[model samples]
Target: MSFSLSTTVVSPEGEQLYTFEYAALVTQTSIALVQVYVELGVIEAIGSMLHPREIARIAQIQRLRQDLGLNLAGAAMVLDMAAEIAQLRAQLKAHQSRPQNELF
Candidate 1:
């Protein structure tokens, strides 16, 4: 049950799962808001369990909405774009790290 910035609780099977209520608590938001996010497909849940990453995503969404004055859909789209950019950057880095073939 560590609340460290980089720590998340995991089960014996190495799966990290938390209830919707716990996710709301962790994000300092309301359970109704959590439910709205789920209903809006902003954050997904498996049954009543949510991955820690989803909780973090919820916090990010809230920050974007409150701090940046973005709407929910805009926030979600921004997050999706950010994730895509990160993935593309990682791929570009990996390609740059590979050895070039001799052309001459």
Candidate 2:
């Protein structure tokens, strides 16, 4: 992934707001997971993968909710993360199969 800063604006209180844009060659599931997080209000914006502990926590919450016979958003998040992990694993396998010299 690569990112570029566009500009920075300073507030009267001396706070800085930096504007930027980023581009990345990413998998489909990565995008899906981001969308899920956004819908759940877990993040302000769609971005990269959540930490492993975060994933585990979400999964645990989902289980607990199910045990209580309650519906929640955590299960959806877990599915999204699982899909992303599978997609990434596939990409890794594909990359590994290519000749070493072909990688750069």
Candidate 3:
């Protein structure tokens, strides 16, 4: 439920990462729901931890599913397409900022 710029958590195994419990709190969902999102490929886990962005995406997916009444597949497709469009926009912006001659 709280957000921090850089919060580090130490696991009993001595690894530094965000716990699934924290991710669930941050996403305002349950651990099992987060796992379901991971299993469905609606979000990804880096090793065994979810990135902050992935957590946010999971929240977005939850909203799409609950508020908009989108099915799991539909929400996944929307998220995927949104990611692709964001990448394409970034590439276009980078290309636009380059020299005209370099575009050839």
Candidate 4:
């Protein structure tokens, strides 16, 4: 969860710029891989709401709007999508943890 960024500048003529050397402390914690899988599933659900081209366009529009002090209706759409994503994630986790051989 923690990260660091480092930049190295070489010669101005050569113009070599290096940024973000990340290193995390390796810990052998007993974290469940299923939890990681569930998190990734939630992320994928959110990601699927936007096409690649729409993502690019949204990024550009957000940047331009921020620079020019403009507002749009995307916030509502994002909120709705977030709600749906949360519901789906909860259902997925519940289903994953359910007992398979329950008697009726």
Most accurate candidate by lDDT: 1
lDDT of each: 0.85, 0.49, 0.78, 0.38
lDDT per residue as tens, model 3, 56-90: 78788888999999998898899989989999999
Task: Quote the lDDT for 40 in model 1.
Answer: 90
- Give residue 50's lDDT in candidate 4 (0 to 100): 22
Between prediction 1 and prediction 3, which has the larger TM-score? 1
lDDT value for candidate 2? 0.49
The digit string of per-residue lDDT tens for model 1 on 14-102 reads 89888777887779998899999999999988776788889999999989999999999999999999999999999988888877873
Candidate ranking (TM-score, best to worst): 1, 3, 2, 4
Candidate 2's displacement at residue 69, Å, is 6.4
Q: After superposition, which runs of candidate 1 have C-alpha atoms over 4 Å from their true positions?
A: 1-13, 102-104
- Residue 22, candidate 3: alpha-carbon lDDT: 71
Candidate 3 ranges beyond 4 A from true positions: 1-16
Write down the TM-score of every candidate: 0.82, 0.35, 0.74, 0.31
Writing each residue's lDDT as its tens digit, candidate 2 over 71-104 gives 5565556555877999999999999999999998
Superposition-based RMSD of candidate 3 using all C-alpha atoms, in angstroms:
5.2
TM-score of candidate 1 against the unseen true structure: 0.82
Worst 10 residues of 2 by lDDT: 19-28
Worst 10 residues of 3 by lDDT: 2-11
What CA root-mean-square deviation does each model show from the true structure? Answer: 5.1, 14.1, 5.2, 17.9
